[model samples]
Target: MENLTATNLYSFYGKSPVLQGVSFDLKPGEFLSVLGRNGVGKTTLLKSIMGLTDRCEGDLKFGETDLLKCSTPQRSLKGIAYIPQGREIIPRFTVRENILMGTFARPDGKRDIPDYLFDMFPILREFISRRGGDLSGGQQQQLAIARALAMDPKILILDEPTEGIQPNIVKQIEDAIIQLNRERGLGVILVEQNVPFARAASDRFLVLDKGRVVLNGTSAELTDSVVEEHLTF
Candidate 1:
């Protein structure tokens, strides 16, 4: 496990900046939730960490290494797995093939999916030969998570993992994420609109407004008043 630290970070797309002077740190094995209304740069913050932004300024360090010097693949190889919005699984690829792609980031050069991933999302095992596009939205979300786990990441970064899924699957995904953090000891950075889940699952939380962090504290500090003031539209 490693600590991910961002200091005075600024991220931009072309000439427009999405993250402005943001600073935070995720301790080893800590579960941190990023909360905000839409378009508040919550997604951009995760992208910046993954080196996906067009340009970034300031320092992003994973453990003792400087992350700004690393490429997207380098970030992945370092054990930071990002499951972005839209659950971007390959539409034409089979479930097994999609999962194998994650192994490309493994430093050990192993290309096999872990059996635990299958146990977490049995639908993926059942649809192992099915094209990724053939799965329902909820199933695709599970596939996305399974694919990320195939890499055996130390830190899992997720953007709205439960959005638009069926209620039953939503509970399953939530339970899985909690299990990953609490039981498996993986560091987690989650960007979510679900305040209830965020509050329940996170050890700490940050509230973003516009492109800056307006409020942040331990999960116990994330109250209804804070959500109504910052998160509720």
Candidate 2:
């Protein structure tokens, strides 16, 4: 467990600027939530850190390594795992196959799925041969997260994890995230719109407005009035 740092980060899409001088630090074994309304560059920030965006200017570092020049796959090998929005699973692949995909970045040659991954998601064991496209939305989300965990990442970036999901499954995912942070010492950057869930899961929070970080503080420092003013529309 360490920290991921983004200093003076700026990103663009063609001529349009999306993230403007966005900066933050994710601590070791800490859960940090990025909360913002639609089109506020929340997803852009995640992509920038993952090396998937067109970086205009920035310095990104994971632990002691500079990540600004690393490729997406290189970043993954450096211990960064991204669970993008929409669960992005390969529909035709089986549960086991999807999990195995995460091992592609491993330095070792083995392609085996760790036993602990199955322990964390026992349902995966039952559906090892089932195709990912056949699962429910919640089940797919679980699979997505489990797949990322299989990478043995030091830091996990999840975008809108609870989106379009049931309350029960949301709780399950939340519990799993907390366990990962507590037991495995995994650092997490969670970008979410569910205010209540984000507040409950995150130790610290950052709010983006118009592609800039407008507010930031610990979860306890955020008041209901502030949440209503900045987050509610």
Candidate 3:
């Protein structure tokens, strides 16, 4: 497994800076959570890592590979899978087809959907022929995650996997994410508004404000007082 490192990173969109001097690291197989209020650049930080930002400056490395020059597809091929907010699955594609789309990032040129994906989200298997748009919000999120896993990523970056989903499905998604990290040993970077889950699941946590990292530390250090000060609105 490879480690992800960012140093003094700056991300911009059309000359407007969104992430200013943001820096952090995700050790191989580690789980990191990002917490911030609305529009504080949590999503921008992830986009910068995937090369989706309009511009970026400073060093970003995955293991020994410099990521600054890698295109989004190149980064995906290198085993970085991003599940952005909104669970953007191809609405017209069937559940199986949406999962297969992730195979395009595989360096081996194989297109088989992993059996484990269906195992992780059984609802997906039950609705294998259903179009993505026809699924409920929670099911669509599951499909999005299944699609990401089909890439066989070394690291998974997710923006609010449980956001705006049904209450019961939220636990399922959270459990799946934890299982992927703890049992499957996938490195994970999560942006979450659920402070309790973030505190419980993360090996480390970062608190952002105004597009900058105002606080970061090991999970144990993310005390309730810290949450109140940095995370509570």
Candidate 4:
């Protein structure tokens, strides 16, 4: 479980720069939260790590492999799973089908969502035959995470897992993440606006302003003033 490092990362949309020399390290089995106001390039940084955005310059590496050279699918196969902000689940597909999609990066013949996923998200097992669109927003979020876990990723990048969800469901998701990190040694990078949730779950914090990391510290070092200045709108 080596760290994933982004060194001097620069990303752009067309000719406009979004991330300027952004960098961070996600250590093994560690939960790191990225906090920023809207349009401050938090999502762009996540997309850059997943290779969804074009890199202007810099390097992204996990262990000995260079992630900048990998395609999105190749990144998935290499053990990075991203659950984007929207919780993109196929509306018409059954919950089972949506979860199964996560395994596409695996060898063609592989079947069955891992048993532990069902154990962690038992609600998904109950809704296996239900259409994704029929579930509540919270349920959809859970399904999105379950699907990501089906890929057996080494690093899970979650963008705002608490958005628009009920408090109870949010707690469930938080518990699941903690369990994964504590029991299975999964590394997580959380991009979130919910400061309380981020403070509760993450061991370290990274705050981005405009596009650069303005602060990097342990959770204990993330003062209220810092959160207000850098993360609040």
Candidate 5:
């Protein structure tokens, strides 16, 4: 149960800053939803947490360890798994191979895909030998999540997981996320535009506007009015 904390966090791309003075505390196994309209730094927030920005300044820590002191790879190695928005599956790699790639971040250096991943998303098991690029968008998203889970991370950062995914499987993905949180005690920081799902899945929510946190509260406070004011574009 590691706690991820960010204080006065700033992230830059080239000369411009995308995240400014961002701060939050995510407790072990807490489900947090990062909500915002398009291009309000929701993705960048996740990137900063993952150390994907060119430059970052502030205090980011997992438990007692400082994340700002760690490299991108080191962050993952320390139990932070990031599943970026595009579901960046390797085009030439097989599903199994793509999933195996995530195991490289394991501190134990274990390479086997966790058996639970297949049980969560059985389609991945069915297409174990198929090329990652050949899968449908929903399937690819599932694969991306499976790959991250294969790393056996303590926390997962997901960006727009259900976007562009089919409605049927969207429910499946959402269920898997909630199941992971409730049953497996997986801490999740999810960036999602789907308000209903966010409200349903998150224990807490943060509303980011133009790179800063303008509003935050328990899930019960994320009403339609808040969504209209901050989350709706």
Candidate 6:
């Protein structure tokens, strides 16, 4: 696993800057959560890291390679697997096909889905032949994660993995995330609204407001008062 660093990062959507002087780091195998209310550039932060924004400036380095100069596919090849909000899996594709898509980002050019992927989410194995759109929201979320994992990423970047998932399955998703971090040694950058889950799963946390980081510290310091002040809507 490698480290990710973003210094004085600014991302723009057309003429407007959505991320202003954002700076943070994700050390090897560490889990960092991005926290904020609606429209505070939380999602934008993830997109900026992935090279999906209209324009970006400042240093974003994954290990020794500079990310700002890399294209979107180049960045993905460098081991950052991004699962954006809304679990954008191909509706017409079978579960197997969807998972296979992740391998396109591999620099090795290998196309096989790793066995660890099915091990992480057995339901994906059970429904290997099913169409992606036929699954429930929770299942789709799992498929989204599984697809990202199929890339064999060094760091998994998730945007609200539990959003709209059934309550019964929320814990399962949470546990899978922690397992990927602790057992498999994958670094994670999570953008989530659930205060309890973020506080529970993260090593450190950052709170963004109107495109700037306002609060950042160890997860132990992300107290209820901090949530009430910066995260609660």
The TM-scores, one per candidate, come to 0.98, 0.95, 0.98, 0.95, 0.98, 0.98
TM-score preference between candidates 2 and 3, better one? 3
lDDT tens digits by residue: candidate 2, 198-231: 7877889999998899999998877798788889
Assess candidate 6 and give its TM-score to the true structure: 0.98
Backbone clashes in model 5, listed as residue pairs: none
Counted clashes in each candidate structure: 0, 0, 0, 0, 0, 0
Expressed as tens digits, the lDDT of each residue in 1-233 for candidate 6 is: 56799999999999999999999999989999999999999999999999999999999999899999999899999999999889999999999999999999888889998898788788999999999999999999999998898788999999999999999888889999999999998999999888888898899999999999999999999999998898776
lDDT of 2: 0.87
Q: Which stretches of candidate 3 lie over 4 Å from their true place?
A: none
* Candidate 4 per-residue lDDT over residues 137-210, each given as its tens digit: 99999999999988888889999888899888988898898888779988999998878878887899998888
Clash list (residue pairs), candidate 4: none
When superposed on Cα atoms, how far off is each prediction in RMSD?
A: 0.8, 1.3, 0.8, 1.4, 0.9, 0.9
How well is each residue in 27-104 modelled by candidate 3, as lDDT tens digits? 988999999889899999999999998999989999889999899999999999999999999999999999999999
Quality of model 1 by C-alpha lDDT? 0.94
Kindly provide the TM-score of model 1 when superposed on the true structure, using C-alpha atoms.
0.98
What's the lDDT for candidate 6? 0.93
Q: What lDDT score goes with residue 184 in model 4?
A: 90
In model 6, which residue pairs have backbone atoms overlapping below 3 Å?
none
Q: Which residue pairs in candidate 1 collide?
A: none
TM-score of 4: 0.95
Error of 3 at 225 (Å): 1.0
